[model samples]
Structure formats: C-alpha cells, structure tokens
Target: MNVVITPHTLQGTVEAPSSKSIGHRDLICAALADGESVVDNISPSQDIEATCQILQAFGADIQEIPSSHPGRAAYCVRGGLKRQDQPLSVNANESGSTLRFLIPVGILSGNTVTFHGQGRLAKRPLAPYYTIFDEKHIAYTTTDGALPLTVHGTLRPGRYALAGDVSSQFFTGLLMTLPLLSGDSHLQSTTPLESASYVNMTIDCLTQHGIQIDKDWNGSYHIPGNQQYRNGEYVVEGDYSQAAFWLSAGTLGKAICCTGLRPHSSQGDEVIVSIIRQMGGQIEGKTELTACPSLLEGRVIDVEDCPDLVPVLTVLATCSKGITRIINAGRVRLKECDRLHAIATELNKLGADVEEEPEGLIIHGVSGLTGGRVSGWNDHRIAMALAVASQRCSGTLVIEGAECVRKSYPEFWQDFASLGGIYRQED
Candidate 1:
C-alpha cells in the first residue's frame, strides 16, 4: 500500500500500543507455565501473532478474549512445552524474537526441529547459539548462519558462554530455556553486555512467572535446575518504541499527546522521552506524555542500548537545529531493514541533510523539509517515520509500501489520521 501525506499540523491524543518486546516475553513464559496464564492489554500485530502461533504449534493451548478497551485483547495460554509426534517445522515469518526465543525450546525437545524464516530475518546473526551448540556437541544444521536451520540433540545443562555484544535475543533464548533443563546452568558473558535492558526485561518476565535467576556481579546469569513456570496474570505496558513516532511528530508539529506508557519501563526505547527533551522538544505529563514543538537543538546519542529508536530519532534530528550525531547504531543495519541506510536515504530524498556512516548517522538539521516520493523499505518503523516526517514537509509526501506498519503497529495510519494528519491512500 502507498500513502500520500499533505503538509499539516498534528495535534490530539492517541493511546500507545502494548510493548511488543514485553508481549513476546510474557507470552513465551505463559506458554511454558504449569497452568493457564492470562496476558492482558495485548494489541494483535504480526510479530506478536507470530509468537502466539509458534507457541500454539509447540502444543500450548491459546485463546484470545475480547477486552472492553478498544485495540486490546486478552490471551489465556495453557502453558507447556509439549512436543507433538508429527514432524515439527516452525516458520518464524520475519520475527527475529520468535525464532531466537524458540530455538532453545526446540533443543529441549530432543527431537529434530526445523526452523524457517522469511525476509532479512534469515540473515540475522545466530552465532551465539551455534557456538554453544558446537561446544556441547549438539547436532545442528543451518543455511550458512541464517535460518532454515535444524537442531536435534538433548541440551545438556552446564556452563553456556555467550558473547555479550551480539544480539541480546541469544542471551534471552538461553535464559528462557535454562530453567527448563534438568540440571542447573550458568550463562557467562564473554564481554560487556550491550542491550542489557532487554535482558532485564526477560528477567522481569521470568520472575513474574515464578522463575528465579541469580545475576553475578560480573554480569553472568545463574539458573537453577528443575524450575517451574507458575501461571499468573500479566499486563503488557505501552510500547515506547511505537510511541517514539508520535512523540517525534510532536517535536516537528503542533502537539501530540500519548497515553498508556509506563513511566518506569525497562524498555530501552523509553529513552525517547529524555532524548527528545535533550533535543529541545517540550514534554509534559507523567503517565500521559504530551510533547510540543520547541526550539529544537541537535545532540549526540548512543544507540547501543536502544537500536529501535534510530528511525524516529533520525526524523526528529532532521527537524532540529545544528548536527545530531547518532552513534553506536551499527546493529540497526541488521534489523527488519537497514535502518540507518533506509532512514538516511529516505529522509534525504525529502531534501533533508543526512549522512550515513558505517555504524551511525550524522544529520544536519534544517528549518524544514521539501517532500517527495519515498519507499518504506518494507519496514514498519521506516514507514511510520516517513509518515511523521510528512508533518514538516512542504509538499505532498508519497510513501510506497506504507502498509508495512502492520508488523508492529497495525493501527499506525489510523492513529496518524486521528492526530489530524492529512493523507490519502494510493493503490
């Protein structure tokens, strides 16, 4: 789908969607629990659905219940890691979290489990798991380092060493599976851990499900054997990653009020609030965030911990004064899209001065943007970033593949329209 956005000021309120990161972790724990678990405040999206469907295929009974709140659904998951007798082939469908989180669970089955994925997901790194699998002499095969991999071996619980700089999803994968092992396991990080907030988020989910993990002062994790996941109710908090888009619009437009965000979330992307303020965007309210246009100034930001914020942050940088340097964002190139390149290229096409670097972006802020045609790069964040950029455009901004926002924020276009953003769909 394509969309044409006319330059207009945006204002009004929109509730943020549930955090996809938290939703994935909660659903995985709920599926592994001893009894039924209720997960509330979930908004259905492609990534969340991928996790739920994969859990179902792993023999967890899941039922979705309608909630009184619009765009929210409750899930009752009868938890277990029961493996079916039939040949097990799981399709991750471009969800990196689903594929990474479930690989260790598949190893626990002691059966040959085949995993497949689409899009750039197949190209994402999985070396962290392979290193351990090799050290433990577990049998596995892959299409090089990508997906369409198969693993057949009993995971022996012991010391599993992983690189800290790699994707934290690997650490999370092991953390989720180690508790299920018959013997205790120690996860040692070979280096300083980046994206540690995600690990904390996983730990938070595990603790909620009655699983306890000890963290060493040196940053290693100690998992006890024979742990059980207890069934309970979990409410997913609003996503700061998705909210970054609307809040970014506030920096460039009139005002944007976003509700449903937790003031103290472990999500790394919550730094968007602070970063916006650092760039001179006015933010007010507590639970309900209100961002208004201010005398925007450029500042340097390290994205090693919050790679997901790069796209929207780049958009904010474009409308600011002086130079905004986004560093430590090399990992963003491996996301659903090459976010650094995509953001630099797409926004530059709209007459913004953005320079792409090997690991980050150097953006020189301009007074305004001259809009033109751009591609969404088949990425949800990129699509939304372009939509928000349109608020400051001097001409109509046409974005191809705008429907890609369904991956994490299906109602993004609707929310954009609700904020008085003027746009029309183009076939």
Candidate 2:
C-alpha cells in the first residue's frame, strides 16, 4: 500500500504498542514452559506471529484470549517443541529476530527444519549461527545465504565462541538452546560485544522463565544443563523503538504523550528518550513518556547500543539546528533493508540533507524538509520513520509500501490518525 500524507500539526495521545522485543522472548518462553503460561498485554504483529506460529507448528498449544489491556491480546501457551521424524518448515516473514531465535530451537528439537524468509530477509546474513553449526558438526545447507536453509543433527552443549560485533540475535539463539542441553555450556564472545543490552534482555527473559544464566566479568555467558521453563504470567511492556517515531513527531509538531512504557526498561532502544532530550526536545516522564515541540540542537548520537533508533533519529537530526552525526552503526546494513542507506536515500529524496557513511549517518539540520514521494524500502522502521518525518515536510509526502508497518506495529497507521495525521491510502 502507498500512503500520501499532507503535512499537518500532530498532537494528542497514542498508547505505545507492546514491545516486540519482549513479546518475542515472552511468547517463546511461555510456549516452552513446562505448563500453561499466560503472555498478557501482547499484540500480534507479523513478526511476533511468525515466531508464535512456528512454535505452534513445533507442538506448542497457543490460544489467543482477551488481553489485560484494550487494543491487545493474550496468549495461553502450553506444551513445548517436539521432535518429529520428518522435517519442520518455518517461515520467518522477513523478521530477522524470529529467524535467528528459532534456528537453535529447531536443532535442539531434533528435527530437520527448513527455515524460509520473505523480502530482504533471505539476504540477511546468518553467518554467526553458521559458525556454531560448523564447530558443532551440525549439517546445514543454504542457497548462497538465501532462505530455505535446512539444518540437521542435534545440538550438544559445550564451549562456544561467537563474534560479539556481528548480530546479538545469534547469541540469543544459542543462549536459549544451551540451557536445554544435557551438559553445561559456555558461550564466549570473541570480540567486544556491541548491542550487549539485547543479550541482557535475552538473559532477563530466561531468568523470568525460571532458568539461570551466569555472566562473567569478561562478558561471557555460562549456562547449566537440564533446565526447565516454568510457566507463569508475563506482561509485555510498550515498545521503546516504536515510541521513537511518535516522540520524534512530537518534537517536530505538537505535544504527544505515550503511555505503557516500562520505566528503566532493559530495552536498549529506550535510549531514544534520552536522545530526543539531548537534542533539546521537551520530553519527560517514566511510566508515560511525553514529547513536546522544541527547537532541537544537533548533537553527536551513538548507534553502538541502539542501531534501531538511527532512522527516526536521523529524521530528528534533519530538523535539528546544526550538524547531527550518528556514528557506530554498520550493522544497520544487515537489517530488513540497509537502514543507513535507506534512511539517507529516502530523506534526501525529500530534500533533507542526509549523508550515508560507511558506519553511520551525518545529517545537516535544515529549517524544514521539502517533501515528495519516497519508497518505504520494505522495512518497517524505514517506513515509520518516514511517516514521522512527514510532519516536518513542507509538501505532501507519499510513502510507498507504507503497509510494511504491520511487521512490528500493526496499528501504527490508526495511531498515526489518532495523532491527527492526515493521510490517504492507495492500492
């Protein structure tokens, strides 16, 4: 779908959607629980559903029920993945998280799993897990880094070395399967870890499931064997990454208050709040984060921990008063689309001064953007970030593939309308 937006002032409240990061972890843990578990306050975005559906295919019974909060749903999950003699087919639907997180689960389930993906996901690198597979002597076949990658053989827990700077999702995949092995396991990072917070969240999720993992002072993870996932109720907090777009819109337009975020969340993307604040935007609150209109001053933004924030933060930087340099985010290239390149290319199309760097972006702040049509890059973040940038546009902004928002925030367009954004859709 294509959406054309008429630049208008945005105000009012839009409840932030449930955290996809926490939602994936919670649902996976719930499905793996020894007994029935309730994952409350959840929304079924495409990626979350991809993970959910795959787990169900593996024999977890998942039923949707009323959510504790309105505009959301709950999952009653029981049983766990089972080994079948035949192969299991799992579709990732362009979600890198589901693809990476479930690879080890398939190996541990003792099933020959053929993992597939859509769009640019097929091109996304799975090299990290490939390393472990080779070391563990797990047979796997892929089509030149493309999807329908099939894995065969059982996963034995032992000392594993993974590159820290690559993708943290690989570590998360192994972290999950390591505890279920018959023997204890040790995962050591070969280099200094970037996006360490995501791994921390994975550990936190494991702990919530009643599994314990110890971390060494040197940042290595130690896991014990024969651990079981305990069933319980878990509430997913509001997404900090999705909230970023609304917060960016607030900075450019009117006042916007977002509810449902966890205060001091372990989510690395929560740094969006501080990033906006550093740009001189009037944003505050804990349980509820509010962003008000303010003239922002450009500052040095780091993408080491929060690469997801770069696209929208680039929008924020474009409207800020001076030069805003976003550095340390080469991994953004490996996402659904090359985010650094996409954001720079699309925003530049809208007459904003954005330069793509090998590792990051350098955006020169202008008084306003002269908007035009741009592609959504088939990336949810790129699409939503463009929507936020529309508010500051001096002309109509038409976004192609705007429907891509369903991947993470299914109700983003509705919420966009709730915030007084004027837009129309096309086939």
Candidate 3:
C-alpha cells in the first residue's frame, strides 16, 4: 500500500500500541509454562501473531477470548509442547525477532523443525546461532548461514558464553530455552551487553511467570533447569517504539497527548522522550502517560543498543534547528532493511541534508521539508518514520510500500487520521 500524507497539524489523544517486545516474551513464557495462562492487552500484529501460531503448532493450546464490550480481547494459552502429527515446517514470514526467539525454543521440543522466512530475512545471517548450536552440541543445519534452517535437538542445559554485541535476540533465544533444558544452564557474556534493557524485559516476563534466572555480579544468567513456568495473567504495556512516530508527529504539529505507556518502562525507547525533550520539546501532565511538543534542537545521539529507534529519531532530526547526529547504529543495517541507508536516502529525498556514515548518520535540519515520493524499503519502521516526517513538509509525501507498518502497527494510518493527520490511500 502507498500512503499520501499531506502537511497538517496533529491534535488529540491516542493510546500507544502494545509492545511486541513484551508481548512476544509473554507469549513465549506462557507457552513454556504448564496449565492455562491469560494474556491481556496484547496486540494482533503480524509479528506477535506469527509467534502465537508457532507456539500452537508445537502443542500449546491457545484460545482467543472475545469480550462482550468493545475493544476487549484476551488469549488463554495452555503451555507445554506436544509432537505434531507431521514434520513441523514453521513459516516465520518477515519477523526477524519471531524467527530468532522461536527457533531455539522449538529446538527444545525435539521436533524436526524446518524454518523459513521471506525477503531480507532469507539472506540475514544466522552464523552466530550456528556456532552456538555447535558449541552446545545441538543438531542443526543452515543453507550458507541463512534461514531455511533445520534443527533437531532437546537443547540440553549447560554453561555457555555468547557475545552480546551483534543482536540481543541471540541471547533472548538461549535465555528462554534454558529453563526447558535437561540440566541447569549458565550464560556469561563476553562484552558489556548492548540493548541490556531488552534482556531486562525478557527477565521480567520470565519472573512474572514464576521462572527464576539469577543474575550474578558479572551479569551472567543462571537458570535452574526443569523449573516450569506458572500460568497466570499478563497485561502487555504500550510500545514506546511505536509512540515515537506519534510523538514525532505531535512535535511537528499542535501539542498532542499520548497515553498507555508507563514512565518507568524498561524499554530503551523511553529514552526518546528525554532525547526529544533535550531537543526542545515540552512534555506536560504529571501522570504516567502524557507527551507534548517541546523545542527541537538538532543534536547527536548514540543508539548503539536501541537501534530500532533510528528511523523515528532520524525523522525527528529532519525537523530540528541544527545538525543532528545518530551514531552507534551499524546493526540497524542488518534489520528488516538497511535502516541507516534508508533513513539517509528518504530524508535526502525530502530536501534534508542527511549524510549516511559507516556507523551512523548526520542530518542538517532546515526550515521545512520539501516533500516528494520516498520508498519505505518494505520496512515498517521506515514507513512510519516517513509518515511522521511528512507533517512539517512543504507538499504531500508519498510513501510507497507503507503497508509494511502492519507487521507491527496495523492501525497506524487509521490512528494518524483520528489525530487530525490526513492519510489518503493512493495506489
């Protein structure tokens, strides 16, 4: 789908979408637990939906409960894996996080699992996982270190050390799988873990489900094997990552109010609020959830661990008064799209001085953007980021391939329209 976003000042309030980062962990935890578990406030996005489907394929009983009232739904998930009637062929689609988190968990069930993904995911690297599997004595095969991987193993619990720089999904995979293993497990990191906030989210979900993973002084994860997860209720929090788009839109328009996010969230994207505030955006309301426009001073930010924010932050950079530098984001190039290049290329098309560096980007802010057609690279973040950037543009910004936002935020366009932003569907 292509989206035509005209220049408009946004107003009103909209709750942020549920965090897939937390929701994915909650679902995995529920699937690992015994008995029935209720997960509330979860989203129906494609990424989380893929995870739910995969867990069901491995024998988890999931029921979608409808509410008598409007806008209410919950999932009842019965945990523990049972062998499928046929060989399991898992289609991960385009969600990298789903593929990485589920693959190792699937390995623990001793099922002959065949994994597949589309587009860039097919070419994305899984070399680190292959090496980890080899070291752990897990049986696995990959086609030239890419997806279409096959793994068959019970994932025996043991001591393992993994690098923390490349991606947190690797560690999240192992951390989630260890409890189901045969023996106690220990994981030590070689470097100061990047994206440590995400690891905290994983640990938080595991703890809520009655699973214990002790963190040592050195930040090693100590998991006692054979500990089953306790089934209960989980309410997913709002996604600060998705909020970045609306927050950006608001900053460029009339003061907008955002709800559904906690101020003290473990999410790294929460830092975006402070970053925006420093850039001269004023936030009002002394409540857990509220955001308003503030001054935007273009400045440099290091997003080494929170690479997902690069797109929206880059959009905010376009509206700043001076040059804004985004550094420590080399890993973003390996995501759904080459985000660094995508940000630079799209921003440049809108008449912004954006320089794509080897590690980050340099954006020289201007009075206003001169809008033109831009590609979304079939990346959800890029799609939403461009839409937000269009708010202060001189003309309509046509975002080709904007439908990619459905992977995480299905209601992005509708929500934007509700907030007084104009979104017309253009073929």
Candidate 4:
C-alpha cells in the first residue's frame, strides 16, 4: 500500500499503543499460569497474534474481549501449556520474539517440534539456543542457521551460559522454562548484557505469575525450580517505542499529547523521553507524555540498550540543529531490518543527510526535508519512522508499503488520523 501524506501539522491528543514487548511477556506467562489470567490493554498486531496462536496450540483457551479503544482488546487466557501426543509444529510468522520466547517451552517435552518462520526471521540467529541444545544433549537440525529448524530433546535443570549481546529474548525463554524444572538453575552471561531492561521486564512478569528468579549485581540469574505459575490480572502498559514517533512529530510541529503511558517504565525505550528533552524538544506531563514544537539541537545518542528507538530517534535527529551521532546500534542491524541502513537510506531520499556507519549513524541535520518518495523497507518501524519524518517535510511525502505498521501497531494509522494527521490513500 502507498500512502501520500501531505506535509501538515499534526494536532490533538492520541492514546499510545499498548507495549508489544510487555504484551508478549505477560501473555506467555498467562498461558503458563495455573488458572485463568486476564491481560488487558492489548492492541492487535501481527507479532502479538503469532504469540497468541502459538499459545492456543499449547492448550491455552484465549478469548478476546472487545474494547472501545480502536485497536485495544483484552485477552482472557485459560488452560496451560500441555505436552501433546503428536509433534508440535509452530509457524512463528515474522515475529522474532515469538520464535525465541517459545523455543525452550516447545522442546521441554522431548516431542519433536519444528519452527517455521518467514521473511527476515529465517535470517535471525538462533545460535544461542542451539548452543544450549548441544550442552543439554538436545537433538536439533537447522537449515544452515535459517528457519524450519527441528528440535527433539528434553531441557533439564542445569546452569546455562550464553552470550547476552545477541538478544535478551533467549534469556527470557530460559528464565521462563527453568523454574518448571525439578531442580534449581543458574544462568550466567558470557558477555556484557545488552537490552538488560527487557530481561528485567521478564523477571517482573514471572514474579507476577508467582515464579521467583533471583539476580545478582553481576547479572547472573538464579531461577528456582518446581515453581507454579499463578496468574490473576495484568494490565499491559503503553508502548514508548511506538510513542516515540508521535513525540518526535510534536517536536517538529504542533503540541501532541500522548496518553496511556506509564511513568518510570522498565521498558528501555522510555529513554526516548529523555532523548527528546536533551535534544531541546518541548516536553511536559509525566502521566500524559506531551511534546511541543521547539528548536531541536543535535546531541549524542547511545542505543546500546534501547535499539528499537533508533529509527524514530533518527527522525528526530534529522531536524535538530547540530550533528547527531547515534552509536552502539549494531544490534539494530538484526532487527526487522537493518535500521541503521534503512533509516539512513529512506530519510536521505527525503533530502535528509544521514551517513550510515558500520555500527551507527552520523546525521547532519538540515533545516527541513524536501520530501519526495520513500520506501518503508517492508519494516514496521521504518514505515512509522518515515511517517513521523513527514511532518517536517516541505512537499507531499509518499511512502510505499505503509501497511507494515500492522506488525506492532495495527492502529497506528488510525491513531495518526485521530491526531489530525493529514494523509490519504494512494495507488
């Protein structure tokens, strides 16, 4: 789908989308719970759907209760993951979180499980889990580090060691499964942890499910075994990653107020708020994240922990005064797309000067973008970031493959329209 967005000021307030990261974690725990779990504040998205479908296959009876919010719904999750007689075949779509978060659980019963993924998910590395499989004597086969991998082995209680820089999703999967074993387990990170906050989020979710995991300051996690998952009610928080686009829109145009966000969120993307403020974005209100039009000045941004913010923050950097340097973003190359390259390439098409680096970007801010045409790179964040970049453009911004927003924010276009965003369909 092509969207032609007129360079117009966006106004009015819009509710933030629910955090897909939190939604994935909470729902997984809910499915593992002993009883019915109510996880509210869910918004429809492809990635979330993948997780839901996989859980359903595990015997979780999930019912979606419709809500007045355009993209929001509540999921009542009952039943729990049960060992099936037949082999489990999981199609994870293009969601990396789903494929990684459920791998350990899928192999717990020694049932042969085949995981199929599409698009870039095939390219995403599952090496960490493969290492674990080798150590645990779990048999597995892969298509040369690609998808359609099969694993048939039992995961037992033991101390596991893996690199933390690859992705935190691996650690989350192990943390969720270790407690179900008959003996206690410990996890040690071989390298310095990146995206550590996400692991913290997993710990918190497990705690709510009546599971306990102890962590030392050195980043070692000690998970107790033989634990039960007890679930009650969990309210999903608003997403800062999605909110960053709208907040960046505010800095370039009219004041935009974003509601439904949690103050002091553990999600590392909350750093977006501080990134904007440091760049001279006019921001106020904690409960309601508000950003007003201001003269933005370029600053240094380190994305070592919050890689998801790179695309949107890159948009914000385009309109800043001085040079904006984004570093420690190498992991972003392994996301939905190479964000470092995609953002730099797409924005440069709109007349922004962005220099792509090996692991980062050096953006030379311009007065404004002389927009023409740009591609979404078939990546959701890339699509949304371009949409946010449109507000600073002088001409009509044409974005091809704009529908990619459905991956994490299905209501993104709706919320964009609600905020008086000027856009119309194009061929």
Candidate 5:
C-alpha cells in the first residue's frame, strides 16, 4: 500500500490502542488458569491473534464476547484444557515473540509440538533455545536454527542456564513455563539479562495468575511446581509505543491529548513520555497527555532496551537540535526488518543527516526536512514512524508499503486523518 502525508496540524484527543505486550502475557496466563479468563481492551493485531490461536490449540475454549460499545471487544479463553496426547502443529506466522513465548510452555503438554513460521520467522534464529534443549537433553531439532522446529519434550525440572543478552523472550518463555513443570525448577543465567524491564512484566503477570517465582538480583529464578493460575478479568493498558507517533505529532501542531493510558504502565515504551520531557517537550498528565509546541532538541537517546522506540524516536531525532545517538539496539536488526538501517535510509531520503551503526544510529538535526518518496521496509513501526515524520517535514512524503502498520495499529492512518493529517494518494 502507498501512503503520502504532508505537514498537518493535529488538534484533538485520541485514545491509544491497548498494549499487545501485556495482552499476550495475560492471554497465556488466562488460558492456563482454572476458570474462564476475560481479556478486555485487546488490540486486534495479528501478533495477538497468533497468541490466542496457540492457546486454543492447547485445549482452551476461546470465545469472542460481543461488546456493547464501539470500542474493542472482550475475549474469553476458557481454562482447564482437556489434555490431548496427539502431536500439535502450531504456526507462529511472522511473530517471533509468539514462537519464543509459547514453545516452552507447550512442552508442558507432553505432546510433540511442531512449529512452522512464515517469511522472516523462517530465517530468524532459534539457536538459543536449541542449545538449551540440547544441554538439558531434551529432544528438539530445528530447520537451520530457524522455525519449523520439532520438540518432543519430556520436560524434566532441572537447572537450565542461558545467555540473557540474546533476547528476553527466551527467558520469558521459561519463566512462564517453569512453574507448571512437574517438579521444582531452577533457572540460572550466565549473563545479565538484557531488557530486564520486560522480564519484570512477565514476573508481574505470572504472580497475578498465582504462579510463584523466586528471583534474586543475581539473575536466578526458582519456580515452585504444581501451581495453578487464577482466573479473572485482565485489562490491557494503552500502548505507549503506538501513542508516541500521535504525541510527537502534537508537538508539531496544536495540543494533542491522548486518553486510555495508565500513569504506571509496565510497557517499556512508556519511556517515550519521559524521553520527550528530557528532550525539552512539555508533557502533562498520564491519562491525558498534552504536548506543548516546542522545538525538539536533544543530544543523545539510549534506546538499547526499547528498540521498538528506535524508528519513532528517529523521527523525533530528525526534528531535534544537535545530534541524537540511539544506542544498544542492535537486536533491532533481527526484527521484522533491519529497523535501524531502514529508518536511517528513509530519513536520509527525506533530506536529513542520518547515520546507521552496527548497534544503533546517529542523527544530526537538520533545520528542516523536505519529504520525498521513501520505503516503509514493510515493518509496522517503520510505517507509523514515517507518518509522524511527515507531520513535521516540508513537502509531501510518499511511503511505499505503508499499510504494514495494520499489523499493530489497524486504524493508524484513519486515526491520523481524523486528527487533521493531510495527504492524497499518488495512484
């Protein structure tokens, strides 16, 4: 899909979409609980759907509960799965998060689980899990360290040590699955975990569902076996990551206040508001954020833990004064696209001084940016970030493959248009 956007003044309030991070965790926990789990305010994204589908295949009775309002509908994934001894074939599609989070938990079923993924997932690395399984003597094999892995796991509770620098999702999978093991399990990390905040989110969700995990600052996790999940209604909070685009656009236009966000959100992207504040943008209220019209100026932004922010932050970086360095986000290369490279490439096309690094990006602020045709890299974040970038740039910005934003925020373009975003298609 093609999308073009010209500078427009955003002067309205919009409700942010629910966070998929919290929603995915809540879904898995709810599925493992004894009673029905009603997940409210879910972002009907492809990634979240992949998660729900996996839970249903595990014997959870999932149903879409009709909503009376125009907002998101509630979903109930019934617990108490009737055990099926047959082999299970699960598709992770393009969501690497799902494959990592669910594969370990699926092992507890004692049924052979075969994973099939599409596109990038087919080439994405699963070497970390493969190595751990080998060390534990668990039966597992993969297709060249990628997806289509078959694991006939006789999950035995024991000490498993894994490197934490690779991806937090691997550790998250184990943390969520270990508690359900038949025996007490101990997980020791060989390195300090990267994205530690995400691990905390997992711990929070596990605790909410009645799973007891003992953790020390030294990176050891102890799981008490035979614990059960408690069923209840869980509300997914607004996505700070998705809200960053609108919030940034507000800075370029009139005050844009966003609702439906929590003051204390567990999402890593919640740092957007704080980052904006540090960059000299006036921000007010958590639920109703108002960005003051001001020039975005900054020296550096360390987005190591929040790689998802790189694309959107890059857009903000372009409008800032001085230089902006987004560091420690090398893992972004492994995302849906090489986001660091993609953002830099697109920004450079828009007449901005941008440089890409192995681990991050360096951006020298330009007095103004002249928009031109650019590529979205078929990544949702890239698509949305560029849309925000267009709001502040001169001339029209034409984005190829811009429809990719539907993967996360389906109504992004519509919302942008509703907020006075102006553009006309070339085709």
Candidate 6:
C-alpha cells in the first residue's frame, strides 16, 4: 500500500500497544505448561499470529477472547507440545522470535521437524543453533545458516556455550528449552551479551510460569532440569518500541500523550524516553507520558541493546540540532531490513542528511526536512518512522509499502489518523 502525508502536527492521546516481546515469551511458556493458561492484553499482529499458529500446530489449543478495548485480546492456551510420528512442518512466516524460540522446543518432540520461513527470515542467521546442534551431535540440515531447516536428534542438556553478540533470541530459545531437559544445563556466554534486557524479559516470563533460572553478572545462566511450567494468567505490558514513534512525534510536532506504558518495564527500548530527553525533548507524567516538543539537540547514542530504536531515532535525530551518532548498531542490518541503510536511504530522499556506517549511522540534524517519496523497505519500523518524520516535512511525503506496519501495528494507520495526522491511502 502507498500513503501520502501532508504537513500536520500530531495531537491527542494514544494508548501504547501491548508488548510483542513479552507476549511471545508468555505464550510460549503458557504452551509449555501442563494446563490451560490465559494471557491478557495481547494485540494480534502478524508476528504474534505466527507464534500462535506454530504452537497450535504443536498441539496447544489457543483461543482468542475478544476484549472491550480495541486492538487487544486475551488468549487461552491449552498447554503441552504434542509429539508426532512423522516429520512435523511449521511455518514461521516472517517472525524471527517464533522461528528461533520454537526450534529447540521442536527437538523435544523426538521426531523430525522442518521449519519454514518467509521473506528475510529465511536469510537471517541461525548459526547459534547450529553450534548447539554440532556440540550435541544432533542431526540437522539447513540452507546454509538460513531457514527451511530440518532437525531430528534429541537435544541433550549440558553446558551450552553461545556468543553473546549473536541475536538474543538464540539465548532465549535455549533458556526456554533447557529447563525441560532431564539433566541440569548451563548456558555460558562467550562474550558480553548485547540486548541483555530481552533475556531478562525471557527470565521474567519463565519465572512467572514456575521455572527458575540462575544468572550471574558474568553472563552465565543455570537452568535446573526436569522443571515444569505452572499454568496461570499473565498480562503483557505496553510496548515501548511502538510508543517511541509517538514520543518522537511529540518532539517533532504537538505534545503526544501516550498511555498504558509501564515506566519500570524491562523492555530495553524503554530507553527511548531517556534518549529523547538527552536530545533535549521534554517528557512529563507517570503512567501516561506526555512528550512535548523542545529544542532537540543531537547526541551520541549506543544502540547495542536497543537496535529496534534505530529507525525512529534516526527520524528524531533528523529534526534535532547538531550531529547524532548511533553506534553499535551493526546487528540491525540483519533485521527485517538493513535498517541503518534503509533509514539513511529512505530518509535522505526527504532531504535529511544521514550517512550510513558499517556498524551505525551519523545523522546531521536539519531545522526541517523537504518532503519527497520514500520506500518503507517493507519494514514496519521504517514505515512508521517515515510517517512520524512527515510531521516536519515542508511538503507532502509519499511512502510506498506503508501497509508493512501491519506486521507489528495493525492499527498504526488508524492511530496515526486519530492523532490528527493528515494522510490518505493510495493504490
């Protein structure tokens, strides 16, 4: 889909979407439990649907309960992953979390299982799992380090060593699966873990389901074997990643009041508030944040732990004064799109000065941007970033593939419209 946005200031309040990261972990844990579990405050984006579909294919009966609140629902999952005699095929669509998190769990079925993925997911790295498979002598085949892989051997519990610089999803996969093993297991990080907060979310969700994992500051995790998941109710908090767009809009235009966000959440992207403030934006209120525009000045930010923020941060940087340098964002290139390059290329079309680096981006802030046509790169964040950046555009900004926002924010356009953004859809 295409969209054209005219220069307009966003106003009014918007409730943040439920946290997709936490939702993924909660659903998986609930599925692993022995009885039915209820997960509340879930927004069914494409990625969440992927996880639910795969879990259902594994024999967990998942039912969605309609909520009075729009765009949010509750899910009841009948627990336990059933084993199949023949090779079970699972399609992950484009969700990286589902593919990575379910691979180890699939091994427990003791039957050959093949994993299929679509779009960039097929090209994303899976080397960490390969390392584990090789170490344990578990048989598996992959199209290089990418997807459409098959595995059949039993996963043994022992000391599993993984490079911390790799995607945290791999660590989370092991953390979720190792506890089900008959023997105790140790997870040793070969390097300092990036995106450590995501692991914390994983640990938090696991604990909620009666699993215990011990961790040291040195990046080692101990999982006791023969652990059972406890069934109960889990509520997913508001997503900071989605809230960053509106908070950024607050800096570019009128004040945006974002509600339903937990200030003390473990989401690493929660750092968006501090980063905006550091760049000279104003944030007020507690449970509901009111971000008011200020004279934003560019500052250096390290995105090692918050790669998802790079796209929106680039938009914020474009409207600030001075230079904004984002470092340690090399991993972002492996996301749904090469985000650093995508942001630099797409935003530059709108007259923003952005330079892409091997591991990051250097953005020279301008007083305002000139509107032009841009591509979403089929990335949801990129699409949303372009839309938010449109607030300060001198002319109309056109975005191709704006529909990509449905990947994570199905109601993004609706919310954008509700915030007084002037936009129209096109064929």
Give the number of the best model, judged by lDDT: 6
Per-candidate Cα lDDT values, in order, are: 0.89, 0.90, 0.84, 0.89, 0.83, 0.91
Candidate 2 residue lDDT tens string, 1-427 = 9999999988999888999998998988887777899999987799999998899877799999898799898999995888876788889989989999988888877789899999988888888788888988999999886788999888887899988898899999888888988889999999989999999999988998898999988889889989998898999988899999998899899999999988888899999988888888889788888899999999999889999998999999999999999999899998988999999999998888998889988899988788798999989999999999988899999999999999999899999999999999964
How many steric overlaps does candidate 1 have? 0
lDDT by residue (273-341, candidate 5, tens digit) is: 989988988788868887767788866787766778889888888889989988898988988998888
- Give a tens-digit lDDT track for model 6, residues 1-427: 8998988999999999999999999999999999998999987799999999888878789999866557798999999887776678889988999999998888875768899998999999998889889989999998777779999888788899988897999999999989999999999988889999999989988988899999966769999999999999888999999999999998789999999999888899999999998888999987799999789999899999999999999999999899999999999999999999999998888889999889999999987889899999999999999999999899999999999998899999999999999899875
Q: For candidate 4, write residues 1-427 as lDDT tens digits.
A: 8999998888889888899999999898888887898899887899999999988877789999865456678988995777788988989999999999988878764568888988899899899988888888999998888899988878788889998989999999999889999999999999998899899889987887789999977889988899989879888899998888888888888999999999998888999898889888888999798899999999899999899999988988888999999999999999888889999999998889999989899999998898798988889999998988888898999999999998998778888888888899895
Residue 310 of model 6 has an lDDT of 97
lDDT of the structure predicted as candidate 3: 0.84
Q: Is candidate 3 or candidate 4 better by TM-score?
A: 4
- Runs off by more than 4 Å, candidate 2: none
TM-score of each: 0.98, 0.98, 0.96, 0.98, 0.96, 0.98
The residue-by-residue lDDT of candidate 1 on 202-271, one tens digit each, is 9988998899999998889999999999899889999999999988888788888999999988888899
Off by over 4 Å in 4: 67-71
**Cα-based lDDT at residue 72, candidate 2:** 96
Rate residue 382 of model 3 by lDDT.
92
List where candidate 3 sits over 4 angstroms from the true fold: 67-72, 286-288
Model 5, which residues run further than 4 Å from truth?
Answer: 81-85, 424-426
What's each prediction's clash count? 0, 0, 9, 0, 1, 0
